[model samples]
Target: MARAGGKWRNAWRKSQKSNLKLRHTQFDAALHNWLLVEDRKQQRRQKYRSLPHSIIHSFSAISPRDVIVFCARKKHDDVAAMLFLQHGEVATYHVGWSSAHGRQTNAHYALLKHAADHFVRCGVTRLDLGTVDTENAPGLARFKIGSGARVRPLGGTWLRIPGL
Candidate 1:
């Protein structure tokens, strides 16, 4: 029975590995083109809400070296934003969206999928989504979950003793 169980476990592991459908892509020149396209769309929707050009410039500067951009499309329109820590371990610091569109299009989903793939390819075993507010950021939590990330509470900060 133990031998049979071992075989079953091995089979399950192999099946899971085979079923893993993560698409990982490296940052390249094509990303610049994609960003331009996304930026143009944001510009067109300036009447509703306009993201500052500085933000795009900053993203462009950082994305090539220490960040990855994950994007999703809605009706051929892409909407997404993210900045991840590229060294040490994979982690996301600030992630936000325009809220102008792509909410119903699941652009966030595609962004997360790409992020996960990117991290895994970079040999990162974990991707920290940072802290959650629970109330104000429920959608953020849901998006992380849909990306197949396990939610775990972060450890509280340490307090240093006065003369220790």
Candidate 2:
């Protein structure tokens, strides 16, 4: 956190001011909450494209011991954000989502920082932050880079047929 720049520092401060709290929760509950919020927004004439139910079910079928889920909440216990990470020697961020109010308060920043801290404490050497496609998501790419992660490109893909 000390290495974070002014923007991230300000975001942390903003999250603090909002009285945001992070807690380890069941994945199903967090997903359910996000879906409910999306439903509410759609009813209010706001459009949202949600992930398919099958995806949620597939994720749920994974063993609980293999994944870690955290949910953020404000002072009034309103859901702020949720993060899902797969753990091993190197933890990998699987999914993350934040509410509208969360975006206003930079809840994602706080949640990510917290995740990093937690992984370090658990002796994880590295974290795979997924992709950073600057062309399509410059803001998201910048966010990942700002979090002190370096870009490591993958090598060329290889294909093999059973009987060539």
Candidate 3:
């Protein structure tokens, strides 16, 4: 029954994983942790610091009551964060960034685990994990897949300017 045993082990492992989605201890802490991760990894740091960060300001603005911030901490220091936004039946996997230390600690796995745990309870029937660059971001693509996220080309993103 090696096959059966393997299946059982997998199930057990899945159950042991922590769901960090919307698992923020405090709004401020979550935001702080997010900034730390982004800063350490240079993940969209400039873009965030300028426009999005200014408009969003606080985590409350983006998540309100429907958002979950999952963070991984070490030695009382924030290392990584995964922010999610829920809309109706869809849970959009927003931005996730991690520090160098966080990566060594496999913080993203924890973040993804947490997201899967609480999505259904939050009225999120489907999870939209956004998109990844297969060529430039192969590791990220694999990470998503490893966490049970299937890839599907939802569509392309477009922007328009009112004044041309």
Candidate 4:
């Protein structure tokens, strides 16, 4: 009877594993479909507009030294914008995206590519893509990953002495 019970336990575990795998597959498919739909919508929007070149130029002019404006063209407008802060000679700090579009024509990728190319030309070795939260923002994480940026943990300060 003990041997029979052990066999039954193993069978149950196998079934559970299969079920988990199926669920994961279904979730992945759903997410992919959602991303596709979103991309299509964004493309349609982009067809009606042009990027605001003057705005970007103005931003660049007003920004302080060591800061550069990063902008991306969209279907109907210029969607994503950010600033890169030059720290000394080697590293560039990403200040975060200020204006982001909701579509998927890979505009963000183009912007990053342009920035990376410009940095390379200017003798900048490293481009910081900013900190990202992976657990709750998986889609954003995926987008960042698609930009060819590696993920790394960022350290933060802790309030150890009750604000002293």
TM-score of each: 0.51, 0.72, 0.66, 0.48
After superposing candidate 1 on the true structure, give the runs of residues whose Cα lies further than 4 Å from its correct spot.
1-64, 73-78, 156-164
- Highest lDDT scorer: 2
> lDDT, candidate 4, residue 133?
57
lDDT of 4 by residue, 40-131 (tens): 45445644222333433343456434556555444444454444655555434333332343133334444455566676877887777666
TM-score, structure 1 vs. true: 0.51
The best-first sequence of candidates by TM-score reads 2, 3, 1, 4
- Estimate, for each residue in 1-164, the C-alpha lDDT of model 3 and write its tens digit: 13223433454354335232224642354545546446445645433232244323354576676656677777677667776667789877776777776666566666665676677666677888777667767776766655565667766668898996
lDDT ranking, best first = 2, 3, 1, 4
lDDT of each: 0.51, 0.66, 0.59, 0.46
Of candidate 1, the 10-residue stretch with the lowest lDDT total is 15-24
Stretch of 10 with least lDDT, candidate 3? 47-56
- Residue 120's lDDT within candidate 2 is 81
Report the alpha-carbon TM-score of model 3 versus the true structure.
0.66
Best by TM-score: 2
> What residue runs in model 4 are displaced by over 4 Å at the alpha carbon?
1-63, 74-76, 90-102, 157-164
lDDT of 4 at 147: 54
lDDT agreement of model 2 with the native = 0.66
What 10-residue stretch in candidate 4 is worst by lDDT? 19-28
- lDDT score for candidate 3 against the true structure: 0.59
Clashing pairs in 2: none
